[model samples]
Target: MNETIARLMNHRSVRKYTSRPVERERLETIISAAQMASSSSNVQAYTAIAVTDPQLKDKLAGLAGDQPYIRECPVFLVWCADLSRLKAAAERHASDKPSYEGAAENFVVATVDAALASQNAAVAAESLGLGIVYIGGVRNDIAAVSEALNLPDYVYPVFGMCVGYPDPEHGAGIRPRLPLETVLHMNGYSAEQSGRGVQTYDETTVRYISDRTGGRRTAPWSKLMADKLTAPSRLHMKSFLESKGFNKE
Candidate 1:
């Protein structure tokens, strides 16, 4: 396989990092790469906060359910789904835009823009031999995160990224993915054949987890995923989006 494909196939989330810092020149390059990601309607409705403040990182780490890595990472970036810029532009042009309540569609567009940009940054970082991890737990306390970041209306923190050199001793290996046959469908869908592979998948995940974590995780992938989804994860997200000035037409 080619180098790009190799890098993609070997993708793994690195949570632990070495103390080596990413210099400003490299940081600007990564941010430039992130900004180059395609945006919806050319709105480019996203912004990234390059956080290096120790106090702010500690506060953000707390808001992210006390995930120590947030503060420990050499560089932390908070990506935002932002409509505030558009709102400001409209106001600056003296246009009379009405009040907006975020719709599902608008939320989707913002999320897509932010996620694409983040992935681009991640790929760029990895190519530079920098280890990185996406911190989705940034949304665990959306209100607190907003307060901590001093986000204006119409902007919401979508997620965070931790970037640094990998701590060789504690770094993890690539995670297994669902078989291509299980995910890739032809002209039509096939649930029966799709369902058949899940049991084998459970066994695959069980073994992977055992080897990777040293026999610490016994539950299969399905069970672990179910536990996370069955609960009220992101239950407040809808209202939170509505609070921002978006989606209302």
Candidate 2:
């Protein structure tokens, strides 16, 4: 495989980090690379808030389910899906004030745009010998996080990312994904293709978990997923988003 492809394939989520800080210049480069990611209709509805302040990081860590990596990492980036700027811009330039920036379609566009940019940042950080992990727990207390970040209307955090040098002693193994056949489909999507490899994938995951936990945990992928689905996860997200002026209509 090519170098870039190889690097992509080798990606692993790093939860523990060394004390080394990411230089401002390098962080700027990563942000620039993130800016190069594709946006729907060039609206570019996203903003990344890099938190280097220890006090702020600690507060955010608590808001984000007390994930220690957030405070431990050199940089904690809160990637926000933002359309507030668009609304302001429209208010300034457009003759008509009848705009729908808060539409459901627009929400999807902003969220996807933010995610695209965040992934680009992740890849760029990885290229610079830094490790990164996405933190969805930021949404656990979405309102609190928004207050902490001072997010305005038409904007909300998509997720947080912890970026730094990975701790060698605490490095995690690369978790295996589902078999290619489970997802790859051609000629107008076939359910057969999707289901064909799940059993095999479950077996692979069972083995992987067994090895990772020293035979202490051997739950298959399907079982884990089922449990996750049954659990009440982030139930406040919908109401929280609505309170923050999202998905109106």
Candidate 3:
């Protein structure tokens, strides 16, 4: 496998982090690397807020479904899909009054760019002997998060990242992923083959969980997935986007 692939394959979410702080310079390097990731159409419609204050971290943790790890991590970064800059640019260009159609499209592009960039930063942090976790729960209280960060219209928080040194006693090893065949398809699609692979991967995941926790209560991967999809996860996302001034047509 390629070197980058090797790094990616070794990736796992780290929840427990040591109290040691990541230095300012190293944090800057990681942020710089994130900025280098490819943006959609070079619009670079993304912004990141590096958070270090303990009080703010605690408040953010509350907004993120009370995830203590959000407060414990040494460095927290909130990635935002920001279309405000482009809107300003258009105004400066004396272009015809802007519309939310492009803003909506640009929001998606910015989200994709921000996610890619943040993952790159996560990889870099891990490579430097740091533990990192992506906090998707930031969306749990989208309005509060936006208000807390003082985000303006046309800017939405995509996700947050927590980075720190790994906790030796509590942190675990790499968790198993679904089998490759389940995810990788040839030129054309084959449902039967993929289904078989999913079944096998479900068993693999069950066994991995059983071993890791030394418990027999592990649910099969299929059931776990069903539980997720069976309920409405992003039901309010459309309205939330609209509230953020993104009119998705």
Candidate 4:
């Protein structure tokens, strides 16, 4: 494999970071790479807010399930799915009133745009030898996070990312993924094949977790996922999305 492909294959989420700060130039380059990511319909409905202020990071950390890495990392970025700019552009140039306010497809487009852009940024950061972790916990309290960032209507903080030099002592090994056969189906879908693949993968995941945790844990991946799914989660997101004028139709 080429260097780029190899780097992509060796990806891992870094939680602990060293005291070293990421340079401004490097951060700019990473963001530039992010902007190069493909957007749905070329709308590019996303925005990234770089947070370097310690106090703001602290507040964000509190909002994001008290993840200390949010405060520890040299740089934190909140990626937002933004449609407010499009609204303004339409108001300025187009004759139509821009019917994005209540459209579900528009929300999906913005969210996908934000996700693609953030992933591009992550890959760029990793290529530069920087460690990073996506902070999805920001969604635990989306309203609070939005308020903290002063997000206006038609904008939503999709997630945050912490970027810095990895602490060697706290480095994480790559966790295994499902076999390609499980995900890559030929022509038509097969439930039997999927079931067989998952069953085999459950065994693999159990062994992997046991080894990774030094035998401290030994539960099948299916069980863990089942437990997670059983728990209540993010019911407020529906109302919150409506309040943000998404999916109103």
Candidate 4: give the clashing pairs. none
Cα deviation in Å at residue 114, candidate 2?
Answer: 0.5
For candidate 3, give the lDDT of residue 83. 87
Cα TM-score of candidate 1: 0.92
lDDT of 4: 0.92
Global Cα RMSD, each model: 1.9, 1.0, 1.7, 1.2
CA deviation > 4 Å runs, candidate 1: 97-101, 247-249
Arranged by lDDT with the best first, the candidates are 2, 4, 3, 1
lDDT of 1 at 7: 94
lDDT (C-alpha) at residue 140 in model 2: 91
Which segments of candidate 2 are over 4 A away from where they belong? none
Residue pairs with clashing backbones, model 2 = none
Q: Give one digit per residue, the lDDT tens place, for model 4 in 105-222.
A: 9899999999999999999999898989999988999999999899999999999999999999998988888777889999999888888888888999999999998999999888
Better of 1 and 3 by TM-score: 3
Tens-digit per-residue lDDT, 137-190, candidate 3 = 989888889999999988999999989998888867787777788788889888
Each prediction's number of clashing residue pairs:
2, 0, 0, 0
Cα lDDT of candidate 1 equals 0.85
- Model 4: residue 164 alpha-carbon error in angstroms: 0.6
- The alpha-carbon deviation from the true structure for residue 153 of candidate 4, after best TM-score superposition, in angstroms, is 0.3
The list of candidate 3 runs beyond 4 A from truth reads 1-3, 97-103
RMSD of 3: 1.7
Report the lDDT of model 1 for residue 49. 95
